[model samples]
Target: MAIIKHAARQTLGQLIGANNPVVTVPDDSQRQYAWTKKEVDTYWADIQKFRLARESGKESASEYFIGPIVTITDEHVKSRSLLDGQQRLTTSTILIAVIRDILWRIGSPEARSTASNIQRDYIARKAGRREPIEYFLVLSLFDRDFFRDFIQDWNELTGKVRGVEDPKKRPSHKLIQEAYSNFESKITAELSSYSDEDSRLDWLDSLYECLIKGLVFVEIQTPTSSDANEVFETINSRGKDLSTVDLVRNFLMERSREDLEKQRVNDAWRVLLDKFDKREEIERFLRHFWVARHGDVKSHSLYATIRGDLTREFDKRPHAYTAGAFAAELESASIRYVDLIHCSTGVDEFDSALSEIKALNADALHPLLLAASEKNDYAQLQDLIEACLSYYVRWTVIGRRESTLLEENIFEVAKEFSGGAGAESILRRVCGWIPDNETFKVDFEEASIPKPSQARYLLEKVEAKLRNTEGVDELEVASSTKVHVEQIYPQQPNPELRLDEHDSWVHRLGNVTLLNGRKNQTNSNRPFPEKVSIYEESALLVSSETQVFRLWDSQKSRWRPEGIIERQADLAKTALTVWPSSSQWQ
Candidate 1:
């Protein structure tokens, strides 16, 4: 009974679960877990790596997985149980299924022989005539549906299942066929890259070792039959997630008829949870609400606190605790509504100052609220602001919080100012420092730059800011600095204005930029061609007309207002980089 490493591809054609600690098979019950397609795919790809490594003459015996060694006796297969790792054994079977299919496809003497050997051992009917699957026989005990899905997907990818599209019957089987063909092509093409077949096999084996070998597992050996029910229940805890009601029911193990308070709390929780319909959002909010109000939130820990029996037996006092009616909420929403939750109200209640956040989505707002209430850390608040800003830029509806404009103002006034990454970062800091929420403004604008809907925003403030710096609120310049924009070229492409008959001048914001009253009027009716000549004559202008044009092009893009698609890639990249994490700011 000494544990030891066992090579997955060592060709040991039996799983008799010898009392040897060197190898074992996982029980079938454990294999019923939902090992996702994504996880399985990753494992297959890794095994391919192992295959290649071995072909390159680098396969190391020092590295091997410690899996189960189950004695797969199909003749008296009453218990198709696993003696070791379920997740690993199940995945390896699927991988073998894949390789076997591929070998069958190759149709060479060696390939067919290998495929036949594989099938007859793991899958064929006659127990005595056929060899047992040499590897991972323990997972054979998994449920039928799991095995069926594995086989179907394998068939689809390996060209065994020919799917067709009959008009309106089931989405033109053609789509499924085509999808399967494409997937098969990708997997096989990837596999075919190896120069030698042995290398390919070893690559697959390495994948198994990397993903499954090192994992810790609860090794259960069934030597005795007593207390098996308790074993099953305890195992279920670590297996699939249990329902809240079921969990709360387990909490009743300590409850008694004399414990009236515990009984009441249990009843209230059940009715409330049922009404909410298992909405994870409502539960999260309730969790936070409990923390904010009572300083202790977990209901399990409060069982004795609410029980009458503990009042005398444990010196529990009648602490006044009231939870607003619990049944007024929803517990679950559709996948599309993952971020959203339903309460008695609607999704819009989050914005309603007077509206209680009964039904809503967690989004960025939920985490922010939790962090603020639970930890009261500024870093959390800042992260919340960033998330909200990013959501804002993307136009995604997640959740709501205070305006970034306000947060930015607060950041600005904190006495440190440095700027990089984008103008927004610098601007946020400046705005926050001013300590005035009302004055700072943010806008989503279309800059004269073409389709690159990058940030076309402007930051401005009342002259009061300057007034504070200079000891006066009103200024000679009026309300604020008049830094308005004038696009030299428009964003919309003018098929009509193809006067040049070339794509030239397509990037102009129509020659827009900051201008004073008289200067704006003087250049109002002139085209950029004429305006440039006139501007070149100005001795007061330090920049040449050529430099100005280049600068304009860089700002808006080479095609500024018209052919927007050309500039979009760069613009999109920038927007994605600087877009605030929140979507709520104006």
Candidate 2:
């Protein structure tokens, strides 16, 4: 059973006012301020609606409940360690700061005085004349200094304070800056609607009052950290859920038996968020990390699965499953995970292979890549990457096999690799999943690549094979503005051409080739002989190859369906050399 010290509804002003305990986000329980533009817009809209309803004196007018906050209070220190609701509290403080800045800008005696009083009561205050000022709400280590210097300590006379860090470099600092600017724009617009200074000041005051008095929260106070953690989990589990990252962090913190263990977890989490700043990136990395060692699990059930599995492990071998151990492992793996995503392996051949895999958008193979990166040397790792790329090109891109089976097989291989399976063993398993050369050739002959980018990638690879150069450089191909994917049989061909079965042949691999400069559009719907002259002058080797099909017959030079079939057959034969099978690898 958990002990709850008190639970009651309180206004935002009552929660952060001079008479209440100072609110602080503890180091072990802090996540960076992560509310983006979408969240800020929603919050502002709600406040506006609530203010209008209250002003209208409607029966529906009621205090707006922002959400619940769980805290552990320490009377001796006169402070509360906020375990939940930091996002709401931090955002609310930012709104107040924006209002204060607007009031100061009004340049009236009453307005400035009201702003000063609001600052002292809700922003920050000094206990005694001689004591240093204490902030009303202190954020975590990552955002504490930036928040204080830029927001809490804004100069009343000068109207600005020097920022502690560059907002562009820090993701949380960027969010804070955006939120402040967003509120300032909206509030200033509202103030501009009133002509006289008095009306403007009144409007500002009303907005401030509406925020402090109208916004409500169910404040749940606990006697100890343990009690606070328990209540936090229970509340979040029932109503609107917290993020998976948040839940997982709190779970680890709650199970930590010592302060050092808790710090280790916090330190690891800080490293992770710093590496992958965006929420989606962090979540994806977590899921990939889990799938690499364990097996396939949906994103929604990841946290529950982690908790259940870890709990069972803890019961069996408590010492091995310590929080500190897991924290260290997670931190170490994040470094490799970053390398995998960014293709910064520092080897040209290896990075090229990784680029091709990325181009294919084969994220299902990340688990196996992450495992191979950990278990193999550079030589073995290179071979494994090539094997995975080949398998993906044949199975998914060409053969168009079902993805579920591929994901399952890759995940199983990743699990084995994580358990010390050799690179050769992993390669054999991946190669076994690939379609045979004959099957791949058949699929390639009939493949219709509708996506221009995918078509460009295939053509570029074949071009590289012809020119005897590395074709897997994603930057060279993806970033090149000079090269374009030209359709030989233009989708909107000129009506005079009288082409038959246009859709059937337009997107086929044979009809697509890379062209230089503006020739793609300039040669649009031109007869085969006219385009043949431009193809012969092309810079790419693949474009020049199209010259062979200029005259399907000597009597009259014209492109026909027979030409497309013959060209695709030749390209299919080349594909076998580009993406070989298991026997070729052996």
Candidate 3:
């Protein structure tokens, strides 16, 4: 093990102070600035909590840990390349700039003096021609100019608004701008609340004091690239919860032995980040990618599994693993993953089936579909997508197996697809998960219809089969029309009709059907005959089928539990047609 040097605890002021003129630069491997307003709020809340504790004498007014900072010293530049903790460091710099601007506006003699000191010590060094340009925190190359401009002339930046045009628009730069505004608003609100100059000056003094003396960091510096990479992984794994993508990216680039390989790795990684801009979404794709390659890995075990697999690959062909080969695989797989997410199924029927799957929230099918997208068989892909949607509908709208069992079944399908099984073979594997007709019918009658959108989707699918119309219009109407699941039997039982026995079936799949927005308001809670008249005017087969109901006893012409059961039984049969079993496909 290489020796990693740990500096004594340093305050934010001491760390950024110009006495050493230490510059912390971001390398190509670092993620762009991604802290959102929520994260900034959390950071400020923690600081305020610390301030309150100290002021109340509940804790020391000295040294509170901000977090750890890991860096590798660059002998050539006489600086440190920050390996982790960029988010905290960058946000803290933004806070300092906020304080400096506030103090400048306050403009008492003492306030001006304090502001000057902060600018010189913490923000930037005005280089003499003899000295190099050094900043306290130099951002990644893409963002550095925008960051430099904001720091150098923040008052002007407030008016400039950082052009929203392309090339000028970057997520990190936007975050920097937003962070400045956030801190400025907070400081302004705080100062405006103070009644007297003395109180305002006193508040400023305490805040500055806390920033310099109280906020602390444990800084560790490694001597070599490998050591820095190792430390970065260890620190982030046990603390702060960096995403799996972040860890994997760092490992690939840092392990590349040659500059050529490093460049290749960086280029490949950038393509992926650009394709999937959101960090959370990229992390999700990474998990799905893992399932596509290996079998099933739990959410918590996902990163470990990836790291282990990459290590094994590196052992087999060190150069290939380090030279962007692994990253290339990820990029290719991600194309399919993105297509699955956006439902770019090329075929209209396949896309329609996918839309229903999404409305039903069958994310378990994503990994399998991602693998399926790799095949040249569009017809087969369509068959698989339809089968998966059918499985999900039966599992979700009807009844479900144990969640773990469902997940295992889907994972097996994905594994088989990856092992080069054709659509028929892989779909043959799916047959075990589809509910039988009797079970599906029983479950359908008893199942509570879900939210309006899902319930509409279910009814619309059944309606399409009933009318034999292509589902294009039905799907559009289901989404665009402000419709709801209208109960055929009103929720409030008809006292004259005596619907108490049917009360339990009121929200069941058979009793529910769709009606446009205000029509539900008009049609709800009416007598059975009045409700039937409203259904007759509706276009949906599921609803309009209600118009022809007959009394089992012509002598007693009122809605009853048996009537609800009979209608549901017919709807259940239609549902079976809409989501047919694999045997029907054969």
Question: Model 2, residue 203: what's the lDDT?
Answer: 80
Where does model 3 exceed 4 Å of error? 20-25, 36-38, 56-59, 74-77, 100-120, 128-133, 141-164, 167-192, 195-205, 319-323, 377-380, 450-453, 467-475, 485-507, 518-541, 547-567
Each prediction's RMSD over C-alphas, in Å, is 16.7, 3.8, 4.5
Model 1 segments beyond 4 Å from truth?
A: 1-63, 66-84, 108-113, 123-146, 152-187, 190-586
Residue 473, model 1: lDDT of: 41
- Per candidate, the number of residue pairs that clash is 88, 0, 0
lDDT of 1 by residue, 1-586 (tens): 2222222332222322221222323221122323444554555565555546544665473333433332222223344344334445444444545656777676656666666655544432223436532222322222332343333322322434222222221111222233334445655877788988776665444443343342222334443222222343354445433233333233332222234544444454434433443334334444433332234324444333333323343333224322111111112111112222332223333322111121112232332233232323233234434444343333321112355543333333221211112334533543232222111111222223332222112111112232344454443322223423334443243454333533334333223332323435445444455455544553211112213453224443343333333333223333333433222332
- By TM-score, the candidates rank as 2, 3, 1
Task: Work out the TM-score per prediction.
Answer: 0.36, 0.87, 0.83
Predicted structure with the largest TM-score when compared to the true one: 2
Candidate 3 per-residue lDDT over residues 275-362, each given as its tens digit: 6645666778888887865778987777788778788878898755553677777888887676666666576777776777777777
Cα lDDT of model 3 overall? 0.71
Model 3, position 262: C-alpha lDDT score = 68
Worst 10 residues of 2 by lDDT: 469-478
Cα displacement (angstroms), candidate 3, residue 335, comes to: 2.3
RMSD of 2: 3.8
